[model samples]
Target chain A: MAMVDVVVLVAGDGVNRAIPAMLLLLVVLLAGLLGGRLVALGVALVAAIGFAVLLPPIGSPRVEPAEDVAALVLFVAVAAIAGVLLSTIVLSDRRRLSAEQGTVEALLRVDHDRAALLRSVSHDLRTPLATIRAAATDLQGFDHDPAARTHLLDLVIDESERLDRIVGNLLSLSRIEAGALLPERQPVDLAELVAACAARLERATSKLTVEVRAAEGLPLVKVDYSQIDQVVANLLENAARHAPPGSVVVVDVERVGESVRLRVTDQGPGFDPSVRGRLFEPFASATGSGSSGIGLAICKAVVDAHGGTIAADDAPDGGARITVEVPIDG
Target chain B: MAEADVVLIDDDASLASVLAVGFESRGYDLRIAATGGEGLREIERREPDVVILDLGLPDIDGIDVCRHLRQRTTSPIIVLSADGAEDRKVRALDEGADDYLTKPFSMPELLARVRVAVRHRRALAAVAHDEVLSVGDLAVDTAAHEVALAGRPVELTPKEYALLMLLVRNVGKVLTHRAILDQVWGPDQPLDTLRTHVSHLRRKLGGGAGAPQLVTAPGVGYRLLAPGDVVS
Candidate 1:
């Protein structure tokens, strides 16, 4: 009889029965809200609650336990289905976002690679062209006077050398960008490499005296011989350009713990104060005219890729000093 | 007699024509190849004494051209590149180019390399002298310009060999910096100029930097010592 009375109340006036049923459903729906499926499964739970409350009571006397159990099962089943759907939708959205992020990153890398290639290519071409022009221009001056022939020939020689440098830079940049430039790691003698670089620098620049301060029998470190050679050469050349004519460009190599440190210092104007913040950034040269600005950037890239560190600072002697540190094992 | 001929390849027509005229005035026969393909064809058809190859080419890569020429021809290939980019020189040499010249180069330097290439070619073909000029364990032929130490030949550049010859001729005797410069480089050469050339010689003749074969007199001049006389 009690069960029958409960059934009668459940089947009473639509508003009275629906209100209590809705309140009970709200309590269950809180689970969906807590599960982060509020937007996905909340509305379905409200409909189920309304149906449970407003349906007319059955004419049969006592409530059928079987029927009550069946209705409850239906409510739980629908709620579970809603939760699953909500979870699937959330997971799919996350996957799409991740994919989009990956694409953007790939695009950025491609753009950077392309930009570096174009800059290096253009720079390489300009060098040879400049050489030819200088050589021809000097020759023209020589033609006006045969005595000037020797001087004009000298100009041609210098420019041809310049052209060689430009080509080397372009090829190096390309290799770095392609990620194909693997270092031939070996137990390198820092003293030997520095000496070679300084010797070459002196040969290239008639006015500079390169002084090397590397102790003999320095322990060897693992590094790509040629790439490090290029880095040293670039630093020496930069020093030669900025240093006063006939001044000494000092190349110092020392051991710091398990790492080797090499520093090239010149008696020239140091980096511009304004550009110090972006020192290793590509195309960050203060001199807007006739400078490639790729030198430091290349140095940074090479050192970083090798898990090394490189820095530039104004020397106490009113010049610039470039210091590079490479681990012995790396 | 005309000077050694050179083939220069570049895309800049005006610059090429100008360089050709310059070379002509110096009594060299200049062949201009504006494209990489053209340069390769020229190298194949008529091998010039020296090829001034530019890295930038319209049709093909300059490095590829350099490699191809090195594979097929023994002609001295000099690479021309821009300033602040010297890494290419090593690569070109590794790829078989004889020497490299950077842009904004003086004309005198160009002629000097030209002379060196021509001299090297002559040395390779002519085998007149077989005796090795020995200094300590190190030996080299003055005429043949071949160097060997401990029975192994030491490769040297044209200028490096010349500098070594001058030093060896005055072995154990300190040659004044001025005297050495005037003898190797022309008169009116700068004082500091000798140091640069000497540094190159020391590297090639023996181990570089603090090697025992060449001794720097610090402010006076330099002396080439035998291997036994190497200072620690």
Candidate 2:
């Protein structure tokens, strides 16, 4: 006979008293599964006493002390065994549940991040595309004067360039994430690199004043020329976007110990305090506008690949200053 | 001088047609080639005044085309490339391309580059032997190795003088940063050095009223305004 049935039969009146003892054993097992051994033992002791008192007289009018003692002992033994067995099963099941929940939460987080990325990409790309379309439509519509036509063409060109920048940033960020950006290093004169970057930027736009200052006889650092150029260019462009009109963007380069230090300072409102820590994180833009928001991130990746460090902080004069230091080879 | 002929080498049909229309409106003859092979053949056949080459080509590599063209003729080659392709752009300039325009460039900007290229070609052909080249009040005496603004002698360092002389010689022509670096500071010199000298030259030349302004082409190069050229 099954253990429960055997216990039920021992009480003699199987219908009323034995069934009650069986129910009490089930409750004790559940308490052990949820609350451990101490709880299960306490419950079992209380139920045993209750069952002994409440059970109806099992046989003829005379109650045998030995038989009654045996019945109570059987009830307590079965309850304790059931409680111990269920506890292991319950604990393992709980562990499996938590593990599954962790995986589910991770998947949800990835989905959320992907959604945010798509939203940001679409918003950044659409603005420039819309401008280009509008400008093209205007160019085709009427017999405008040469100057007016040129103005519309300028708009189209500028907007397209903006779109190109966004696309470039996206590709660069993806390449970086995929671990494909292995910089091909060469001995590069940091002063010349900064000047070339400044000159290129100056040629693109005439508004901001880009002043370059480098210590004479700065040491040449080994770096990928093109990648370092992109870094400087990104910083200058960021400064140009944030700095007030007619403000100066200063690019300073110097030799610090065994490393080359380059700093780009812009006379702007300074780093946004709220997003300061995450400034170099992908998609963590301070403007929260049409910017690709990966400029600083790219700089950081390129710098890190070169065994260098980059940091952003507020300048003493209340402007954004970004500093990059790369060790120079002997 | 006869009307200048321009050859554009690019695979993008839409952009070519648009550029052709723009150039035609500006009174230049425009011929479009769909591939680098066709472009070289066209250049060889027509010997156009200026060649506008696209860096990304369907057949031969753009830089190779530039190197090959440099061997064949001295006609100015203006490269068209996408933005952020600075390395390739620099390589093209090194390969003897006179100037370059980043893609999505305005028609006016392209025209400006063309004008600079054509002017540079003419300047090369003419090869002025005059002792003093005058632009407004700025005079550069090649023989004396001196510069004077408004008849007053301006003392300049050798590097600054060399930079000024280059701009004066190529007045109204945009000299690429690499080109300036090559001519003034030799090859592999840093661009910042060029900028420092240029800034000092600009200040000494007087960018104030009635002075010949040292105009910047931003990302391309610098040009010294000719006496008759408008400041804008």
Candidate 3:
């Protein structure tokens, strides 16, 4: 302030003099924001004293001094600077509030999703339990034909398997969420993994057969064997649950570029475009038919843990297709 | 597989009860012991043909019981365990349990495993070292040290022959890598080399329908499937 005042005094005081003084106010405002109002007040007082020492006395009469005009210009500049600084504070405060509101909105969305997942899981678990209870309860009376009794027993077994799948998926998802499960890595053959998964799921899937067309001599993808099996099994399970009875679920595996790409195509109802966006979310079953609902979520988590990518889309021949790609050495 | 005597050690009465019903229908006499000590005493007294031990015994650690039982009896010890720990299962198998069934296993599946274990023990008891052993169309003539698949003699290297003979002797059983390595390569070989050898053998044994399959049990072991046998 003293430097600018001396310069203005030597060069004839003008409107430009107030511009430098305005910069001093901006510095004070910035200091106010950084160090609180006390520091700002101290800086402002020093600036005012500097101005007093540098400027002409109030009673001094020079040869046609334009002190009134310069004082008016300085006052206006100070008011404009103060106005902008105060608006900046208010604007920043508003931005912070909106940001916090965004966080709250996100949290609400997550809470709603959690509630939906719980409902879906409860429904899924209870459906199989209800089936098992009804079948076993009927079988206990021992009044039905042998074939009927066998069918009831089969239902109990099937429902129990379903329950097992749901429980397994929930455990896997929780482990993933807790970051407790570190995949034990191995050099695994993808074809073998698919075959093992198909064999395991064959009993549970009543009609749909997991037909694999794996390219021979696939590079041994370094991954966690059991984890990858879970991923493939979940995909096949989802396919079997959705595909029409007696339809073939085609599992295609091949080395695509640097990654091994696995695609499971089901002749079921294709993914509705609306739900495709959240298809990987837990409990987002393509068809709401008693699916454990965490299948895709498991697939996503396992594949992600392996540094791989998973995707879903409508098949060209009127079905849904889930594709997964894992690096050979990942 | 006549009506074999069995001793089951499980704290869960529900499993014991269910297995009792299952064994009765399957023509086996089951002796239940709720604790590991009782199980060992039963084994000492009766010397059953098969022992089903649940590793989650209330009184003792299942693995220690497994070790003790392995030292006490020649009967096959088929372990019952909860899932999700390959290490525990491997340790059990390494502790001399012939086979294992994960918990919540279906009745039929458990029965199948029991049958396999009994049959395995019988095979072990009745082994004549010089006799010919076969699974599906693949046969190993111990007399001549020759391996043949589908009437076609498939020449194998020493390691390959040893591996094939080991698998043939224990047909329909999942042999852990360590088990195979300990017997074939004397417990000193890397697992990756074993995998490579298996893949080579699998490629050599590749055929059309009815070919014997060296079915892979991921992260655990391999099972040789008879030509027409379906995977469990």
Best by DockQ: 1
> lDDT value for candidate 3?
0.74
Give the winner by TM-score: 1 or 3.
3
TM for every model, in the order presented, reads 0.40, 0.55, 0.43
Q: Model 3 over residues B1-232: C-alpha lDDT tens digits?
A: 6488989987544346555655665578999997889999999897888898877664688889999998999788888764346887788877878777765555556666677667666765666464888766777898899888788888888998888888877776678998998888886889988999899899878765757789887788886766755337
Clashing pairs in 2: A192-B190, A202-B218, A203-B218, A203-B219, A204-B218
Model 3 residue A15 CA deviation in Å: 64
Ranking by DockQ: 1, 2, 3
Interface RMSD of each: 7.7, 10.3, 11.5
Ranking by TM-score: 2, 3, 1
Report the Cα lDDT for candidate 1.
0.67
Tell me how far the alpha carbon of residue A9 in candidate 2 is from the true structure, in angstroms, after superposition. Answer: 1.8
Q: Find the candidate with the highest TM-score and give its number.
A: 2
Off by over 4 Å in 2: A1-7, A11-14, A54-70, A203-205, B1-232
Per-residue lDDT of A160-180 in model 3, one digit per residue for the tens?
A: 887887888888988988997
